[model samples]
Target: MSTIEEIQAELRALTEQEDEINESLDALLQERGVLEDQLASLHKLMPNLGLIHNDAKQLTGMISFTSQLADNVSGKVRQLDLAKSRVLAASLRVEDVLDLKFCTEGVQTALHEESYEKAAALIHRFLSMDEAVLQLSEDAAEGSSLKQSFTTLHEAAAKLRSLTHSKFDSAVNSGDVASVERFFKIFPLLGIKEEGLTKFAKWQSAQTSTQIEV
Candidate 1:
C-alpha cells in the first residue's frame, strides 16, 4: 500500500539514525579505553606508594629511637664526670695528709740528730703545711688529722730552740773557742746570726783586755 518514494524516504532516515548510533558507540568505546589505561597506570604505581608509606613509618621509628639513645648517653656522660671529679678530689686530700705527716717526721729526725739547719728548714716547711691546711674549708680541716700533728710539732720546735740558746750561752761564757765556733755555725740556722756575732765580739774584746793586763 506504500508508495515507492515514501519507502525510499523512510529507508534513508533509518540509515542516518543507524550512522549516528554507530558514531556514539565508537566514542563510548574510546572513552572506555582511556579509563582502562588510567586504571592500569594506578595498579602499576600501587606497590611503590605502599613502599613509600612503610619507609615513612620506619623513618619515624628510627628518629624516635635516636632521641631516646641520645638522652641516655647524655645522662651517662654526666654520671661519669661526677665520678671522675670525686676520684680527683679524694686523691688530692690524701696527698695533702701525706705531705704533712712526712714533713713533721723529718723535723723530728733532724732535731734528734742535732742537725739544726735541717731541722729549721723542716720546721718552716711544717709552718707552710699548717697554713695550707688552715685555708681548706672548715669541715675538711676539722676532719683532717694534720691539725693535731701540727700542734705537737710546734711545741717540740719551741723546746729545741730554748735548749740551743742555753747551750750556746754556756760555751761562750766558758771561753771554749772550738765549741763557740761550732755553735756559731748554727746561729744562722736558728735565725739569730747578728745577735750571736755581736755577743762573740764582746767576749773577744773582754779576753783581749784581760791579756793586756796580764
Candidate 2:
C-alpha cells in the first residue's frame, strides 16, 4: 500500500542500521581479541610464577635447615670446649701427682728410719694426692698406674705402722726412756692416741716406783 519512494527510504534506513550493528560487532571482536591476548600472556607467566613459588619454598626449607645445623654445630662446639677444659684439668692433676712422686719416696724413707711423724705428714700429702687423682680418673689415661702406686704406698704404710707398734712395745718393755720418749711423740702422729697413752701411763708408773725404791 506504500508508495515507491517510501519503500526506497525504508530500504536505505535498514541498510544504515545493518552497518551500525556490524561496526558494533567488529568493536566487540577487537575487545575479545585483546582480552585473549592478555589471558595468553598470563598463561605464559604461569610457569615463572610456579618456579618463584618453588624457589620460595626451597629457600624457606634451606633457612630452617641452616638454623638447625647452626644449633647442632653450636652444641657440639660447647661440648668440645667443656671436654677440652676437662682434659686440661686432668692433665694438670696428673702433673701434680707426678710431681708428688718424690713425696711418696720420702714417706718410705721416713718410715724406714722410724720417723713416724715425718711419715705421717708425707702420708697425709699422699692421701690428698690420691683424692685428686680419684677426682680426675674420668679424664686420665694412666689411671691404673696411679692406682697401683697408691696401693703400693698403702701397703708400705701398713708395714711401717706394724713395725712402729712393735718398736714402741720393745722400747717400753726394755725400759729405754730415750726410746720411749722418741716413740711416744710418734703415737699421736700415727693416730693411736688412746692406746699409746694407756701404755705410756703404765710404763711411767713402773719407772716412778723403781725411782722411788732407788
Candidate 3:
C-alpha cells in the first residue's frame, strides 16, 4: 500500500478510538452522579442517627437508675417491717411484765385484807397467764424481783387455803351456822371442792345427831 493510504487508514482507526473514549467518559460521569445522590441521602440521615444514639444512651441510663431505686426502696421496706415486728414484740413483753407485777401486788393486798374473793380472783387471773411466756419475762428482768413476787403469791395462796380449812372446821364444830355456810361457799373458790363437801356432810350429820339426842 502507498504511504498516504496507510496514513488515511490510521486516521480512521484513531476516530473509532476517540468515539469509545467519549462513551466511556459519559458512563463514568453518569456513575459519579448516582454516587453523589447516594452520598447526599446519607448526609440527610446523619443528624437523625446522632439523635437516636443519644436517646438510646439516655434510656439505658434511666433504666439503670430506676432499677437501683427499686432495689433501695425494697430493702428499706424490708427493714421497716423488721423494725415494726421488733417493736410489737417488745410492747407485748412490757405489757406482760406489767400484768404480772399488778397481779402479784393485788393478790398480796387482797390476802392481807382477808378479802378471800378478791384474792381468789387475782389467783385465777394469774393462773390464766401463759407460764412459758411469764418465765421468759422473768428471765429478761433485771434481777429476781419476779421470782420473789411469784414466791410471795404462792406462799399467800397456801396460807389462805390453810386458814380457810381451819376456820371452816372450827365454825362447824362450834355449830355457828353463818360461819359454816360462808366458809363452805369459799372452799370451791380456794380449789378444795371435795374437802369442803366432806366437811359440810360431817356438820350435817352432827346436827342431826344433836337433834335426835334433844
Best by TM-score: 3
Deviation in Å, model 3, residue 173 alpha carbon: 1.4
Q: Rank the candidates by TM-score, best first.
A: 3, 2, 1
Worst 10 residues of 3 by lDDT: 134-143
- How high is the lDDT of residue 108 in model 2? 76
Q: Candidate 1, after superposition: displacement of residue 183 in Å?
A: 15
Task: Evaluate model 1: give its TM-score.
Answer: 0.45
Q: How many residue pairs clash in each candidate?
A: 0, 0, 0
Candidate 1, 43-142: lDDT as tens digits? 9999999999999999999999999999999999999999999898767766666666786788788878977767766655655553564446325545
- For candidate 2, give the lDDT: 0.77
Model 3 stretches astray by more than 4 angstroms: 1-96, 137-139, 209-214
60-149 in candidate 3: lDDT tens per residue? 999999999999999999999999998997788777667768878998888778887788777666656675766775564444877776
Error of 1 at 51 (Å): 2.1
Best by lDDT: 3
What's the CA RMSD of model 1 in angstroms? 13.7
Candidate 1 vs candidate 2: the lDDT winner is 2
How many Å off is the CA of 77 in candidate 1? 2.1
